[model samples]
Target: DSLVKQIDAEIEKYFSGENPYRFTQESRELYKSIGGTPFLDGDYTVFGEVVEGLDVLDRIAGLPTDSHDRPMQNVVILSTKLKRK
Candidate 1:
């Protein structure tokens, strides 16, 4: 979807638009190239980032999902740790 349509969707679902403080053209481009859900830009809380787990992420993403988009088997998160710079 075009950027305008994505913003329109956010407004339609949440009755408000993207957070002006957080939304930007660069972010929009990142979302587009990364297969992200742009409509979630401001409405969702970011849980965490996979600083060192691209292969694991890819493996999980490759898992088969059910009709509702849940993984067919339970995928337990083994652990999480903050990676300090």
Candidate 2:
């Protein structure tokens, strides 16, 4: 199935100096302050980071959701791309 084919197991790092891309000190500190799960460092996969539009993310995350956590309103993916140096 195409959906099954799209599934992949890839490791992603959430900390600086570990992944191909680095998160800012501010972000790292924010993660710590927010009590992010650093304990699951190597367990699951992260895949990518959001370099911008975090404000939008916060707004969406703050929206009321159902028991399953799906937003009551629709959210759409407009575009996405990997960062390149």
Candidate 3:
């Protein structure tokens, strides 16, 4: 989809040094240490964030994570659906 392509393009820009927020060595190392895998595995997509559940998202993001940035407990999405705007 177009959205997915856009996300991939943005990621490529950051990784290829075309974006101002390019990944740094320290960041990469930290990510690896925290067990954060590269975003290539499709765990996330362009249209994944939920506007109404942002508080929950913030809490999850704040959780204690391992060296690879994976949280100690698994956070699963039970389901997702779009609401009429």
Over the stretch 2-81, how does candidate 2's per-residue lDDT look in tens digits? Answer: 66544432232322235543569996898879756554655778777789989989999999999767899999989877
Query: Candidate 1: where are CA atoms >4 Å away?
Result: 1-30
TM-score of each: 0.52, 0.44, 0.43
Ranking of all candidate structures by their TM-score, best first: 1, 2, 3
Ranking by lDDT: 1, 3, 2
Stronger candidate by lDDT (1 vs 2): 1
Residue-pair clash count for candidate 2: 0
Ten-residue region with minimum lDDT total, candidate 3: 40-49
Q: For all the candidates, what are their Cα RMSDs to the real structure?
A: 9.3, 11.3, 11.4
Taking all chains together, the TM-score of candidate 1 against the true structure is 0.52
Pairs in steric clash, model 1: none
